[model samples]
Target: MIEIKNLKKVYAGATVVNVPQLEIKKGESIGLVGNNGAGKTTLFRMILDLIRPESGEVLSNGYNVAGAEAWKNYTASYLDEGFLIDYLTPEEYFYFIGGLHQQNRAQVDETLLGLTDFFNGEILKKGKYIRDLSKGNQCKVGVGSCLLQKPELLMLDEPFANIDPSTQFRLKNILKTENKNNGVTTIVSSHDLNHVTDVCDRILLMEKGVIIKDIATSSSTLSELEEYFGVGQIVTPEIKVDKEENH
Candidate 1:
């Protein structure tokens, strides 16, 4: 379970995100949807402890995520290409992560069996640095590595941004399988409603860094969410600034 209390972040003396409270239970999948720069990535970064929050706490199963190293081992995230080691091949990256988790090659191979088709037998081959791989292939490596350890809490930011439709569908099934069988708590942030609706048990809608709507997918329709986001308010292009640009 993940609990966030009054979480807030600031950049250059300006408030970038604030969430009063939120609790995501075990085996639950949640989706975050917002316009560009609405703080979805900021919130995800805070949860993963990659970025510090100016105020409040994030707890995973009673462990303070921002206060301990144990949380790092149990929390797995794949937000962008930087998460992958650009200098290493895909197989090398997997072996490196496996070593960190104290897993042998056979165990790593077993864990990676589900992804073999995606790798197309090339991930085990040598000679290609991760940076030389295509964006979609890089994402596959990042994702495969994150799941290599079977962490309890999984967080992904715009995971389907560069992947193809077939892989996106495969990823959706993989997320569902993980959540169902392993009871992993998953939080996914995406701009695409179809992706979210396909896998998320709950949906949180953000506007200008504030969560304006939280709906249970079982009880809500996609059209309802569309109406909420499409309220005809004029959102200026001023909100399009990237996180680094704003920093």
Candidate 2:
């Protein structure tokens, strides 16, 4: 269970995140959606104790995230490439992270077996360092490492941003399967509305550092999101003119 109360963050005298109160029940899969600068990442950072909130607190299973060590045991998150070791190869990186979670080599190998199709054989081998892999591949490595931990609370930011379409589908299935089997609590933030809606059982819409909507996923959720997003927005197509024609 996750409990947030009066959480706030300020930067240069501007408030970026402010949540009076929120509770995420155990075994819930939640998707947070918002445009850039909506404070989605800020909220995740607070939850993971990566950033010090200006006020209030975040509690994971009754343990304050910033004040206790208990939450680290069952919570895992991948917000960006910074979580990965660019110097290590994917295989080496996995083993290193797995070791941190007290997973032996054989157990790590077993955990990785479930990710073969997600990797598409491109992540492992190829004799490349993590920094050398493409951004999409690096993201795969980060998410795979997080999953290897078998966390009770998993968090991801923009998980679909750098992945290919086919791999995105596979990753969704992976999360769904994990939820079905383990009831792991997941909170993932994404700009890709369709993908998040497809994976999450609940959707929270963030706007200007506030959660404006919290709705359960349903058959009509996509259309509802589309309708909500379409309000007061202008999408102008670029006009292209041939150089010769312009001359």
Overall lDDT per candidate, in order of appearance: 0.82, 0.88
Which ranges in model 1 have alpha carbons more than 4 Å from their true place? Answer: 120-122, 234-247
- Those runs of model 2 whose alpha carbons end farther than 4 Å from true positions after fitting are 233-247
The residue-by-residue lDDT of candidate 1 on 1-247, one tens digit each, is 8899989898998777887788888888989988887889999888888899999999988888878787777778899998888898888889899999999989998988978766656565757999998888888888899889898888889988888888888899889988888888889999889889888878887766777667778534478767756885544324432211101
User: How many steric overlaps are in each model, in order?
Assistant: 0, 0
TM-scores for the candidates:
0.90, 0.93
lDDT of 1: 0.82
Candidate 2 lDDT, 170-213, residue by residue in tens: 99998898787899999999999999999998888777777777
RMSD of each: 6.2, 10.0
Worst 10 residues of 1 by lDDT: 238-247
